[model samples]
Target: MELEEIFNEYILKSEQLIITKRSMNDIAQNEIKNLNQKKEKEQDITGNKNSTHSMDFFFIQDVKSGETTRYKNIRSTVDEKIKQIVLQKNKQYQWILSESFEIFREFLIKSYAYLGYKDKNIWPLKDYGSIILSEIENKDYSFFLEQTKTKRDVPESILNIFRNTFPEYKKLETCNKLDVNLNLEINLIEHFRHIIVHCGGKTDEKHKLIEKIIKKSGLWNNGKYDSKHYDFISSFFRLKESNDIILLEIESNNQDGFPNKYYDVLSDLMNSLNSVAYLIVNEIKTIVK
Candidate 1:
């Protein structure tokens, strides 16, 4: 397929992903509202505003011993239910963001593959150009794109691969467009992806890679000054640093796990990714001859 066609498909998929996230969030918010209404109804029936209802209880079973361990009063009230749902929805956000990064990564890989397929003159290593082109034609560019899902420095690694392969890549407008904040946000998204997939959204605060991105993004630097720079990163999520561990916590009010203008935040992140992808594709159009 043509490079532009490939990128167009990627952009469509990215848009759909954002739409799906927003739909799911709307469903979640509706559910929360219903739960609150139910809580109020139950309160009126009981004639006590402070009274709590036991809506559900949770337990775990021990298979070997044939014994069940019940957690008392867990998920018993509307408040608890709301909390659990919010946390689960936050996890869903992480998963969606993870998939978003994957889509972006694949777009990059495909663009490079297209270059290798169309232009042998631009391959950095003259001796192995034919072999690389053959591999790309066979849909076997894993040698170039594999291991790109590593826990850290993913954005830089992607640029490095292209830069090392085509020395002119460093001079490309696409490269120049990848300013520090954009790179920082891309890597931050990758880190959040790693936390959800590998660490379940919990990791040591001293995780050097995560800390580095946070510091560079001005999210936690200089005594936590509120910087208006990170439009998407700051709005969608916040770092909860405590007990020497970092958490992938969604920023929210005490009553809800979603922040004000939550859907806008998701759009902001998706739009930034889309903008970056658009820039790369435009540059690829100039090179793929």
Candidate 2:
């Protein structure tokens, strides 16, 4: 596809994914609210109440067991639903990142192909070639050489390839730096993607990443509370703004002890990916001319 066509397709698909994520989030939130309301009503009816008369032993035992089972079922269902929603959201989040990356890579390949580098053996840049080799069946040196024949001995990084391939575009230097920064910022997302795909999103790596993010947010300082970390945590988590500064609340029983709203995190990630992709694509277009 043409560059514009590829970009539009990506945008359309990404937007649809975002919509689906929001819908799933809304469903989860609504279910939680309804459950809370039901619990409140049940409590109102049952709280501080005593039986007027003593009942038969077995009958009372059965009644108590039934009530216990009812409450247990409610809690179990809510927890299960929340877990399912979170897993589904994480899956969607991973898919969005992977798909966006794939689209970007496709754009790169197509751009090179457009520049008359049509040979399949010459198209995959070295960095990308190594990644492809690791995933594919062929693990031979000859396969690697064939895939990256254009610069086999002196393989170039993606940034180096972009820079060397199109030196006439001076803006590529800054754009390449932006890409590096974007990749760093999105590394956590990538880690989550890896964990979700390979470990069912319940690995120690996920926990470590979560801890790393928490530590970086500066919320905990030398075993003391620091109110100043609020803005950083908020912005990092894309939480609500306070005095024009983003702030997040650490809630107990949330996913990974963070806010249960990973939908917001995924949304922030999607926005970043879209913005960076736009910038890179436009920069590449400038080089094409």
**Candidate 1 on 1-289: residue-level lDDT in tens?**
6776778889888988878887778888998899888888988898766455455667889999999998654425678777768777766776778789889877876666566556644434532434445454444344333322321354654556565654544454234543535555666777667776887765554345545666655467555534454444433334343221122234445565544622345455666677767766666666555
**Candidate 2: regions farther than 4 A off:** 48-108, 115-159, 163-180, 206-263
| Candidate 2 residue-wise lDDT, 70-157, digit = tens | 2221224434554555556545555665565555444444444333222234234433444654454444434433444343322113
- Model 1: lowest-lDDT 10 consecutive positions: 241-250
| Regions more than 4 Å wrong, model 1 | 57-75, 126-155, 161-180, 206-210, 214-263
TM-score of each: 0.68, 0.51
How displaced is residue 9 in candidate 2, in Å?
Answer: 1.8
RMSD after Cα superposition, model 2 = 12.2
Candidate 1 CA-lDDT value: 0.61
Q: Rate the local accuracy (lDDT) of all candidates.
A: 0.61, 0.47
Locate the minimum summed-lDDT window of 10 residues in model 2: 239-248
Residue-level lDDT for 217 in candidate 2: 33
